[model samples]
Target: MTELSRRELVTFLASLGIALPLGRAAFAQGTGGGGDPAPGAVAADAAAGTLIRFKEPVPYSFERLVEETREAAAKPYDPVDVRFADTLERIDFDQHNRIKYRADETLDLNDGKAPIRFFYLGRYFKLPVGINVVDGDTSRQLIFDPKLFQIPADSPATELPDDIGFAGFRILEPNSERDWIAFLGAAYFRTSGELDQFGLSARALAIDVAMPTPEEFPRFTDFYVGPSAVGGRVKIACRMDSPRIAGVLEMDVKKDGPIVMEIRSRYFAREAIGRVGIAPLTSMFWYSETDRGRRVDWRPEVHDSDGLAVVTETGERLWRPLNNPANVMTSTFGTGSPRGFGLLQRDRNFSNYEDDGVFYEKRASVWIEPKGGWPKGSVQLVEIPTDDEIHDNIVCYFLSEKPVAKGDAIAYDYRLTWAKDQPDRGRVGEVVATRIGRGGIPGQPRPPGVVKFAVDFDGGMVASLPRDAEGVEAVASASRGELGKVDAYSVKVDTAWRVTFDLKATGPEPVELRLYLKRGDETLTETWSYQFLPLAQTG
Candidate 1:
């Protein structure tokens, strides 16, 4: 797909009206205590009209849902029957935003403590999904009615049928006006995170991303929402379906200080799959401090995440700074039952971003911790080139060692934490900044093919070292280049240690570089692994 089309698809899927800055009072009504009503009951607001209507209750459980999904996989994939494609398309962005969910119509869960709101199907979101409210062992599907929304008189949505299903839903924080988590378009979902600003997103699964063939986007066809066993948390169970796969996913989401979600997914493949990405994360990485030459906007930096941090099964820490390469790039790190991994926006300085509108500094970093023993696999990182921050060009996920075949049943369980920083903070120094420039002495002529790299390290042991500390050395290596002028020393301005090196590429191929710091026999910093594109030498 073209870059613009890809950006549109991902951007719209990640967020629509869910992240808009609407007033809290608009969604703060109907907060009184009330239990879930019986089947066929109508949640109505006398002044605002009917809010929600439910169909007959159905027997529901996680196990039964899994069995149902497996049976669906055995049959041919069934596509969603969009009710009014033409009319819905007329409800463009402006018109769609004008149609709002009335505040009094909010669906109350957990004894009216948790408020839920629904999104109306519009131009981009035509394929609708079933939404159900679960109470104890039974679930009642919400019947779609036009009365739930306040549609503009000129909007084309009024022409659509009343049975046109919902586009997605969002969960509002109790006693607050803000929404913490939202699921919309495809199987994509995201939370406001610890910063209360939506940034990166997580998907149910990713199939053959960055492969030669077109990527398959398995969408959530149904969502069952209920109260979690853990008080003050919400449990969401989703049924996902695609041409080649069908799966069931359950997430117990808690929004306290940070958003924590325990996710369990089970998949039954209908066809042989080349690549299956479990716990896939999607974020935008257009440009950062490492490659400032690619900046197109006035902002100092524009990206949701700046690097990929991995904790290998062997307890080694690796940090790979993100890049916006000239071409699509895939980097694979062999991780056998990894301890943890995440895409981090480590830079918290507001001055670094300068843009107060989006507050890039406040974007939350998501960390994934595997629950059970995951099979031997590799954490694959795919970086797609983009000129703007609209596209979500960075995707990373865990790829299984064993290929998936038809009728293969696979399962994965993990915990997702949307926090201010990564959860696993080791005693080793962490990479703080990465910069590249000309490779010669300041007063000397710059080399044509050589590039200079300056990486700063701080935290852990590096922060404790004295300025006059001795015996600390920089360890550097390249896969296909000559490394020289290596130097590591403490900077007078900050507690961080600075490491600089010159790398001369011997060929046109990209070079993989590894660097770290050590004192005597002790390793002092996490390994900084980088992929240097030959074209980036100009920067």
Candidate 2:
């Protein structure tokens, strides 16, 4: 998709109250089986192989898909056209929810080890993706069948043609109604995380996100789903294409408390990508305890994630608390072969949120770990302002230091872990919470041109330290500010150490603050980094 068209498409989807921005397509004419075939009957002509039919399964492999993507990228881009007739056009949220896929019609793989279901085409998701079932070295494309869905006879979706095709697909838990993994719009896919609730989404490829120009969204045109080499995991090969880029992604996904995806991807740039993001993650962060004054919600907190956690190449763990800034903010942490990074929902106390409907505490943290020789880059974070929780206002990804030129062959290997907490590689204390307020001593007028931060650190060695532990000290610094009243004290409530400090800003420019707890020069916690935008400047 071209940059302008992609922006328009995503804007349209957001108008309909979707979670993440994804491209959509206009209706186009296509041909498929006219009627619903028998349960195991072929639905396409055997002579034509652009699309597959049950008549015969053809040979397929990930390498073939990679070659196909490479060749496609070498040529000009072609966008798909999609259309939905009468009832389907009126498939609003309620009506769409009513049109459910039949469990019996699910595509089974490895003798029912994996059961896949299709999502019906709707107003928000108009593009159709090819879905194929792979077995051994061969694969068969599943034809669209109205009978696959159980739609209300009175629903407008019934007016759609027999070959309306599928919007996306999802993988269901064995013997359960809940789905653990799903691939929806564009190149977006997500799992139900460690807590069994959907939160953030991971994209196959990201081009020029948070740049001056509009972001390019690569769409997955086709997906080959089959059993994995290992038991209990499903393998999906995706063909991604866009105006600026084309790529192939092979993902082996499995759910065992924490949902894990072993992703192998290769891309060919049709044009020089200004800024490409690897293992890009999209999420929402409206407001939390750190900026409670800015929040106008009844709930105590509202967000899918609260901070961006990173383990740098030098073994330094940094936790940068996320913010819904007044304007777009992009922070880059340079590293070489970084260990991992993620958008984390660290505060898991239900009492802190009191959101029973959309259990924010149950949302999962998504961490990206590079598997092979990762190129040098910076873990970049983009925080966009949002008034409500529906919009995904936060994005994090690894950006290579060098730009991707046209015809460049790009490859990356990474594993995504969607869990409740990131692995404690440092085994040191970590930031549990961050709160900000006006700076001043109690019972006195709040000081001007200053901000107070109360950061709580818990877990690992810090939590084990006694209340009267000696040698423990708070270390704080700022890029462009004067630090004042910095001290670490034990809190009674959560067995965590609270570091209270005040920052006297030198100017209206944003201040980069860093702090941590230590005992006689021995580091005791992960570094806490934050960008403090002066109130006067933010307004």
Candidate 3:
């Protein structure tokens, strides 16, 4: 992750997390994986030929196709090729996510609406996903048909090949008129953000990620998309392989309010991997809850997620507030086949953010549910302290045995729940606000202290007590400082309580602190954890 625009950063400095523009490789590849729309064959798939016509039963079977491709890719990267029909040849991005396959043209005509639309190929996306519609053995496969799409007469759109196949497809609501999910870009795909507008993305597999060395990103080379009539769901099965890994994917995308995708993937490592990330979510967490008065803009926060929540395999729920560090920060929590983890937006107040456009507070919280029992590993959260929001800053995933190794078979399945509220297992004492300033008391002589902290926590049993309640105690500790007087009492507004404390930072290194309210024998709320960066250099 790199730096972001000063404008976006100033507003989102509290929850800072970032990633650079999808380098060309992160976008897609031409081989067997689901990558961007293959660009070179832009103008034409062939010099000239009869438009591919579907007669009756298409001969292709997605299941058999995947089994064969996986076996072939198991050897080495010889570059699996697709002999595409002319109609499925050259399309662009605008044309990709927008080209709606008409109701009459719906391939699987079993039920309601088969959400079918294609992704066009272009600069950020180049690898073409081999798409073929099946009707038993008589598969009326696809060809890049420019007529199916009506592009706004623009610069990039006008320059594309007339017969380019669609880059990928987004599934529309089977009953409603809107879209529910999409499989586009690189091995990248997503449902809409908090407001039903698409932002940020999730990758099927990540290799050598966040390393100083150049990373390897595998693309989804082909797709076996179908309709699941048995369970009232849409099924999308993907065949994935790269220079480093190979696998299969079966995703059942369903919709309630926010669409949910239950994904199961089988991964095979072709070589030793330094970092293997499972259910990796790439997002921007600029600022939220912590850094406020120092903002460079009017908005209080700008971020896609505000915290990291992990449900260990034993069901112990832990919430770590997201941070915007001055440098790249990576923490690997050593654990077993973790139950689940994800980037989340816990606060859902509009006034807390005060921004009308790009609702930072309303952003969705994505929860990754493990497919099965995973082996011992770590749930890694990489936070790159940055100044802007354009660059993605938050990456949460599972780092497996040595990242990767030759002849390693890694399989995982998880449910992705996209919603506005976080998935907190208990009455966790959630962290509300964290304010930092000079340590001196108001109107008193300023001391030698450089920094002070005021952390506010609400929710749980902490609010039901009286102003003089003594049964509840505030347990506070710091890694490198003398902790000061800690006090707790019920707040006047909303049945919430306020816990205030001060810390005298004693060293140059950051101070790690954890605090929670407990009434003697019982815990009142979820523990609030924080990592405070040391103050700036003074004269």
Candidate 4:
């Protein structure tokens, strides 16, 4: 993605932060996404959250069973045979999100910390993650209760056969009455970004995210949920399966303090897996401060993640601003035993988003701080070109030194911070804003052959320097376009310094853009790398 599209992607993805909480009774009454289950399937006499009696209940040891997942990966991947399409395929968005398990009928065994609320089947979400509860040595099925939910008068959901199950389930607040996390939609899940607002999604694993072949979305085939040790975090074990790989995951989740999840996975590759992305975060970058100039709309910015922040093993911090180009783009920051990397929504100002419906400022900037050292690797970011804002185009993940193939096992441990700002790792200047227009001096006809750009740098070294500080200069280069006179000047009104330059494009093609601030060659600010969009528009 280029600078122009980055601005637009920022504007679009930021708007998707509207996935708010479903109220108590409000959820049960919701008929959105998908409708209710067939009434006939839900026996007329059955009440909500009832004990589901069916196949002989088989009890299993939680710890021993989790380890079994590791053992299961050693064998040839056996495809899961459960199918539930008739009840899922016909459903749409509203019906899918509407499949709210009744709040009153929440599964409460006094075993798991909280009862589970199941999401209904619908269009976007059809396959449900199997839900189960466990105690010291016993496991039980969480019965599906229809009376637990309130249905709309015209709702088309009919309670179906008792044997029918759910897609996946969401874990509500552990200590508080709030809903902090959820396990829904694919092998995807996420906590509210730094601001407690759910935005980007973290998948258990990505088979081939940016590949041409249809991206195969694996499901958490089953969940072994159990109670936490007295006053401790809950332990939910997961078993994942796809045509390509199979593995297990143990999520040790806490509530108020920093929410950290430890993930250990192995791939029993059906064949050579294409691209494996660990701790992959999925988000959208439509347009923002730097790329807004290319937009023809009313909004100022849109995006869930503005840039990709990577910390190398040597402790070097690098920032790569996101983009939405006319074509797919892939960039990698070389590093070793990466300390951390993630898609961040660093810009936190309401003015950035004029749309009152979706508050972008409150969106969380998730920082993936690895708990243990990840072997030599690079933080790879893939940006896919997108015209509209609905599709997520930004993907960030760490590639380990180990090449991915069949029978390969990978264990990754990372701490997911749900706070607002990045941790106090180091001091560095931040890219405040980026803008573009006709390249030339004021009062002069716009330079015929050049595209002008203005980049703002604030905070860190730049903000502390004396007003008349010398040595500070702008370091910039173009991947293809020719660069002209470049100069740096303070904005006067703010602590920001604006770097202006003209790029002479050879033709209609887009160009890769890069810029940064330095003092006597000592780098003081983040290197601002961007993609300059070249769209023909009437002035």
Backbone clash count, each prediction separately: 0, 5, 58, 51
Clashing pairs in 1: none
Candidate 3 weakest lDDT stretch, 10 residues: 24-33
Tens-place lDDT per residue, model 4, 1-539, is 00112222233223232122222221221221123443432322344335433233567664465456667766776765435556545444344334445444555534445645666655445455567777666777665544444443344445344345565665655333345566665576766543555567777777676678766676787887776664556667777887777767666666555566655554455556778777778887778876655675578887777888777888767777787776777777788888877777777888887855446676667777877667887878888876655567778887765678876666777776656766644666777677777778889777686778888888888787666778888889888978887998777866778789998886656577788888886777877777665653111
lDDT score, candidate 4, position 373: 68
For residue 466, give model 1's deviation from the true position in Å: 1.7
Write model 3 residue lDDT over 309-398, tens digit each, in one string: 777766555667787877777877665778778887777788877866555665678888776677788888888766666666777788
Top model number, lDDT: 1
Question: What does the lDDT read for residue 130 in candidate 1?
Answer: 93
Model 4 error, position 30 (Å): 8.7
Model 2: lDDT equals 0.78
* TM-scores for every candidate against the unseen true structure: 0.92, 0.89, 0.80, 0.82
Per-residue lDDT over 1-539 for candidate 2, one digit per residue giving the tens place of the 0 to 100 score? 00112322333245234543332432101111112332433233335433323435788999988897888888998877767544555776545655666555566676777667778887667778888888889988888876666666676766778788888888767665566777777888877788877667788877787778978778888899998989988899998889988999999987788888899999999998899999998888888898877868888898888999999888899999988888888999887778899999999999989976557898889999888778888899998877777677788899888789989999999889999999555679999989988788999988887788999999898879998898899989999878998888999776799999898886567789999999986899999999887852335
lDDT agreement with native, every candidate: 0.83, 0.78, 0.62, 0.64
lDDT of 4: 0.64
Worst 10 residues of 2 by lDDT: 26-35
